[model samples]
Target: MGLRAKKFTPEVLLSAPRRSEGIPNSDASKVLYSVSTYSFDDHAKASEIRLLDSKSQESSLVTDKNGSSEPQWLDDDTVLLLHGDEGGVTHIKVGPVQHFGDGSYIAGTIDGPVGNVKLVRIGNGTYGVALTGKVKPCGDLYNPEKAEKPVTTGREFDSLFVRHWDHYTTENRNAIFLATLYKEADKYKLSELKNALKGSKLESPIDPFGGTDNFDISTHGLVFTAKDPDLNPATHTKTNIYLSASKNFWLDIAKGLPEFFEVPISNFEGASTSPVWDKTGTSIAFLSMKTDGYESDKNQLFVIPDYVTPGWVIHHFPGGSSGQGTWDRSPQSIAWGGNDTLYLTAEAKGRMNLFTAAARPTGLNPVPSQLVKGGYITSVKVLNSGDIFLTSTSLIESSLYSTVPADHAKRTLSGQSYYTLPVDESPYDPKSSQLITKYVSSSTHCGGMFGIYGHQVSEISWPGAADDTDIHAFVIKPSNFKEGKTYPLAYLIHGGPQGAWGDSWSTRWNPVLFAEQGYVVITPNPTGSTGYGQKFVDAIQNQWGGLPYEDLVLGFDYIQKNLPYVDTDHAVALGASYGGYMMNWIQGHDLGRKFKALVTHDGVFSMTSQLASEELYFPFHDLGGTLWNNSESWSKWDPSRFAGNWATPHLIVHSELDYRLTMNEGLSAFNVLQTKGVHSKLLYFPDENHWVLKPENSLKWHEVVFDWINEHAGLEKYTVWRAGNVKKQPEDS
Candidate 1:
């Protein structure tokens, strides 16, 4: 059979980090607190650890490494440390240090396979350890028989058993307490322990304005930082420190102890809390949003003194007030540092850096200073001997370092031995960029059916490509593509009218995956893509289907003339969301008979209806005003006006739970297609949301769309050619 006449099977487009999930963290500081480089050689991998000192400086390693180590101060001469394995298991060890980087130390392993652990002083000469682990009825602390042992005294205690415990206080010992989620406040005594622990059950705290919540907690009062709502798929409100403590420690408060502070509704409304107590325990410092309309920045510092009015006195930091900076600066880690001085780790110069501040009066602002520049610093610990321990990271590696606060000289401690991993190179390298090309070929084409690895071709460019323009095209000659044969081209549109179709990784919208299905896919970032600049982004504002649409059409024409093998008669218009909106709009206005099929996914049909029913007013604000205010512009570009003219066969795929665009928008377009008797079908996912987050539903969505395109375009018979294998034809035969 001729190359163009062979029956081809479509290829499945798979996402890289395929079986291996992408590391869940966006910033390196969040994953590896402190980094220290050991060697500068090409072959020698560097090592690093999260340490206790803030001023310690180190270099990057040249080799590959694994896991992490965090150091904590046991005393002036000794330290308690955690060594983590590749499997995420952490081992506790106690060690002695000589100098900052003396390369000298003796250490002893204390506990193995421990989960999360925090140190607490229980009593005079005694300490209480709180951790997160499985609870067993009665198991030996050392030498467990099972591969997985149940925890008896950690965060998992409540899951194993439920019991009410009384609150009590001892003279000098620190106390550790645990409880189930069922217990209420007024049960735990807070005054008896050297330090108190509280736990919260809310996954995320709900806002007073009725937005989604974002908090989660274990049995103890340690507050885990809540992630950005946009970044995390899970959305719950994280409780304020007072509420979290009241929920878990209220049951254990002693009868004679001071009354628990009542958390004001204003504090919980639109802000989160990070509570840090002074060593004297008479004062507390917290981070909160100043919602009083005076301060627009979401991060501010507040202090509460027991002797004062018992309410918090708010103070705005340098970057805490609105218009002071462009980035959001939250105090991640804070230390007392004695002499009323406070050391904090925060994002300063586009990266995480260390800063110091001194406490003034309750209502007075503290003087701030930048202690360290660049790199991300985690936790800072000040020892009685006037030395500091900290965990920090450079662009390449993370490690533990200590320095005398007086001179600021720093040195590496442990975890300095394994800086040999290649993956620990310059932390600033564009890791996401490398994954994009792999994802494009693995999944984008063939309805995500097959995977193809290791294929190289030439760069296809446009006549006016610029330095700022990263536009590259690929051509896959059909496996059965005869010497004189031609095939239909599918100009696939990417969503994120603001998003770019670059050499970046995407779990969806794969081109190779589409190519495997026997259709040539052409995708271009018309404008408003990120990476480009402010002008490109602002170009699409209120001009959705204008110049950007022109760019797509121009690119299409360029490809058609450059690649004559494509059959213009069988061309199709396919896209989802914004892309869907473009397809619906163009089909009505443009006289393009080359495209025989149109597949729209959750597209916007009527801007008027959309502007009226959208959950928020921002979309309208972004449009420069309400539809009534911009009727002339809205009417000239609205897709609904063109719906009456659409004649191309189309398939509409929408999810009912898509609040962003909503299901009504898709129905509006479907109604138009139905009235015109245009070959059309509406596929609805009742439980699915905007992105088809579910694995099974996503697979089904892809299958149905490809089936419709193949059936309408008459490419179903050549399924094998859709699998990514093609015959190379002569340049000019």
Candidate 2:
């Protein structure tokens, strides 16, 4: 008897009735954070901690709050947790694991001074800390007695025009204070808490999104923070690493007591942060950039040597291909397990994988292996045994897993031997793991299903680059697809031009959603995508609209011609960021009538305005200059220059707080559509940043986008006309 294939419906895929989230944090810990949800709309917004017993091989769930920031083990019994509030205090809780129902463990917050912790580091029973204080600038160190009290108009007020992500203001400026950990019989508490840095206006963890992870303290009581300078936050933010002994320091502008001393020199010309202390102390390893003013430049791994003068010793690792030890892939965070073992979460192809290498500069091209890939590895923790516990999420899975090298101490030192994952070379699967349960829902009234449930999701490749480079693309077939039936295509262009539409699951631009809407979805990760190799990625650098665009065209042509069922005539081009720029390019350039409609979200309209986006370094490094210096270089790629030919109906989406693209970008495109009198609609999210994160907003965004695409391209062409938009013959594709 032949085996029957599993058939799923859109309702089953979109509904996603029930699923348990694995640990979302990449930070290493004995307990993992897991959150379960009934549906997208039915989630309680709280997280659960999954504690595994090494001795018993048993796992239990602990109820936790969504406010929990970074969770780290305090000791054998206690765990330190950081919680942040937008309008309230930063809660720092440290206590022994609390057992709740049955075998579940819930960490209870310590009800003490630790409640206002902005950043913390725990060692045995001793905790080094930084607390937040709201202080209005007064000439310079007005009165220590009046530091806590709000100042009326008795003294001059210092002003800073700070703007970030979504909002701006001076009221939330925080002053960093230092403290010591004191425990009262198992109850964690804070003692000797004083203004470690006074009379200075500096937010250690920055604000909004940054927290404990941005700052690190050395074993010798030296605090290193990559922080926002006390000045007007502008389109360009230059964050220099400040190293100061863990003592009371002050920055009085009037008296000139610079709060923190900056690093004098570095291998890279740009900003630096994420300092990881070597286990033996005396040195620091951090992520660095080569171009000043550009935050998105090639991220290189650098180490700070124990020298008499303050400077960084750049290490030439695998990614650091430049003679000076610079790598292209961006390093998110760094952690040291041993003196020579440095583990990094870096981006390549499309996945953020864990890599291991020597901790210091060897002037050697330290080959870093993708210990764990096929997903987004957010953070890592180093245990005494050298085993790594990490949180990884994919296009279809979520959670944490543990991986141990055969002999990491030796492998990392050699920087040549490869590390391995518990699972073999396959997509990260959550269903096979015993820790998480398969989502089962008895309720039939939830919502709809999606692409992954009803169709096959696979990655395909075709020749694209001039050197016959094979460009990778992700394709999702429609649900219950039949032979000889043509389906409309949702050709999605990924942003980043430097980024890729990875193999992982996503809440935004979900191809499965389009597949559920009765369209064959194809997402091409042409040149500039990571994972492929440095050459393929570097090809898209100065040639953003060049090689990457050509590769997309070739990939699209191949997909339509080869798939047979992909209805190219009735298709649409959709993208965000750099992809959006290509959508505009399509309206002016190639594929005359390939896409019936277009959807662009948070995409660039003009390189001129996009140059100084958020940080000046990105434009400076990528384009090689600003709008003034290299007007001719960026001019050719400007979408508005060729807007006269934009006849296709378009849906423009942008956010007010997306400093990267800025609100004017969408407005400019919308204005051009109005001037051209083209069929267009502008969807604006005032509260959202670059991505639509809010639940309701996201739902609305999906509904609007889903409905728009269906109405324009995904809708079924019921009537069988002699010659419809669909291909008359497979060969015509």
Candidate 3:
């Protein structure tokens, strides 16, 4: 027999190489991207900016510094990179893309660290740059000096946002700043910067996950998104896009234009983001939600026709009915294919697929058609030649880059045929429609250092908790597999009650990693999952522990009845965030007794105490109301109510810095299990937030988690400490 394949253990998983989106230059001749690799020797990560020749498929390191990131192209052959100095000051360095490392020179420096910086050419010699930086209480750039400690160490706030995801809120807020980058005395110099929201209370690129995607700049003006200043951020999800007519960077273009004023572009009371300008700079397109409080509402496409002229109209491309053909999915990110055609990436039937729409003349509501499927399209860029550059990831690949020509052939698969695959059918069996296939053959692959890992991935659907509904799930078989051999089951529940398990790759809770450990991993997207449609996504509202729990139960039964390879009797279940909540839910019910063990990470123990979460709007929307008015709603599906049934071996993981679901949630669950005399362990991280992001912490997290499950499954444990030379426990202590 051939040599056995290497197991992707926690150590190997931590060291897996990663690549960011491939950013193509003007003519699509070269691409700039970043590669990240973990160094267990230092318990740190090292990143390098690399340049790839699109034609030759050859790449070389541009910068070896770990601090460098977010490289942007200044022109066809020039690049700008963001880096932080030893003093923590942020600098933008510019140089020719061909000049690997030494030729780059500092273009400009900000007073402090900034994020989401975007540079655009406005005229023949002038370039404009926009960035989000923290502004201090003194209305000046926030730096170490401005952040010096006061006599009083305590912080006081009059707002509802006393703290955010990880840290307490201060007077400092992130604001958008614009400046012109020009050459002076043969050295690049930035002109006096102007604050986009000078005296306004608004802030650009809302906190937590917002970045450069929140704003866009064109030769005509600048457009950005900011939350509604009048509404309480803790309860509302309204963000609007603002447009500035004053061409601050180009005075010639500013003349005869509307007076320099920043004005709201849309009146819609919902979340608006991803503002982008067309190639001609005559129109703008973005995605927005209509609901006021629901953060997960369906995103509607909107475009501004003839924005440069007076009396511009904001046209909305409606879904469902507004004269448009029936389109049920929501677009997550958008880009202009040309002046009129729009390319979008949206979740569809457990996959993040690309679609094409139109930015029309008027009164025309064109439905978005699926242009490409399979793999998660993380980012897309349309070149001037109408070709599309895409960066995507899938269960087998870490990162991928592809170029689809404007006149590419489309393989239109019948939705009925693709969706009607048998529950036992392997995703690869339907190769033409199911496998992760790029639209065009011109593709580059990176981070596939270990080959395809010798595993089979499949997407299968089973009967749902409700009639006429089906629940979808992704399954991964162990790397080393024999036909008739059975494997322990690792049932993983996704965190977003609003999220779905798709053809995507994730560092945390990776199904491939579990499969490598000799278990059959199944990630089920039951009720409340997106990609199915908005109705299914909204089904979990106020029904938290009802439908989704039943769907998962049915999923387990389906595996037991059909997939002979999956041994449900010898199984363990794990989840984080909402998934964590499901684990606690499973514990209190009959499902808890079926699993050999359970792991809950940053889960919710009690819905009644969910008010402790930072985003009050999440609870407000998901739970239906507040504690005073809807006490029954909060207590109906509370996991604490079912704690008496806990008996399985349990691992509770919670991070101290997770303000979303406070540490108390996990600690409370551990306490309940202990009180019930159940075998349990608590893995607490004081430095982590809702997710374990640090490399070292992540490695430890996987080790402890895998060890717990392996112990219950009768497999070799993975914890390194168990092998260390430690004193044996006293017989009688």
What TM-score fits each model?
0.46, 0.76, 0.90
| 1-733: candidate 1 lDDT, tens digit per residue | 1112122222122111121111111111111233333221232333444322212322222112254344444444444445555443444444443332333222322232433344444334333343332222232122233345546634422121121111111111111222121112412111222122223122212221211112122222233223223321111222343423332232333322223343442443334555555554445566654332111123455555442344555454543234222223455556666546666666532245555666553344434555654334444656554344444432212222323242331211111111111122222222344211001010112111122221311236453222354333444443334566666777777676655454322345655456656676666566554333334544666777776676666677787787777776688878887788888877886734557889888777877765433232333433655577777776777888877788988899988777667788888888888999998999899887666745456556667777788776778733333344334321121
Q: Is candidate 1 or candidate 2 better by lDDT?
A: 2
Candidate 2 all-Cα RMSD: 8.4
Instruction: Report the alpha-carbon TM-score of model 3 versus the true structure.
Output: 0.90
**What is the per-residue lDDT of model 3 for residues 1-733, given as tens digits with 9 covering 90 to 100?**
1122244556655676677888888767888888888988787778889888866657888898767888988777777888877656788888877874878888787767777877777776668778788887555677765456788777766778778999887777887777778877765666655666667787877897888888887767777788888998888999877776543435633233234333344545778888888876668888887777888888877777756552464555543543321567878998887776888889998888888766673465556667777678898898878777888777766676766656551222112221111112122233455433232212212223433442378878999988789998988887577899999999999988899888777888778888877799999999999999788988999989999999999999999999998888889999999999999999999999999999999999999678888789998888888888888989998999988788889999999999999999989999998988999999999999998988889989998998999889877786643355112321121
The lowest-lDDT stretch of 10 consecutive residues in candidate 3 is 416-425
- The parts of candidate 1 lying over 4 Å away from their true place are 1-450, 454-487, 502-508, 612-615, 717-733
Alpha carbon deviation, residue 635, candidate 1 (Å): 2.2
What are the RMSDs of all candidates, in order? 15.9, 8.4, 5.8
- lDDT of each model, Cα atoms only? 0.46, 0.59, 0.76
Better of 1 and 3 by TM-score: 3
Q: Which segments of candidate 3 are over 4 A away from where they belong?
A: 1-5, 184-187, 246-249, 252-267, 309-315, 319-325, 361-364, 409-448, 451-455, 720-733
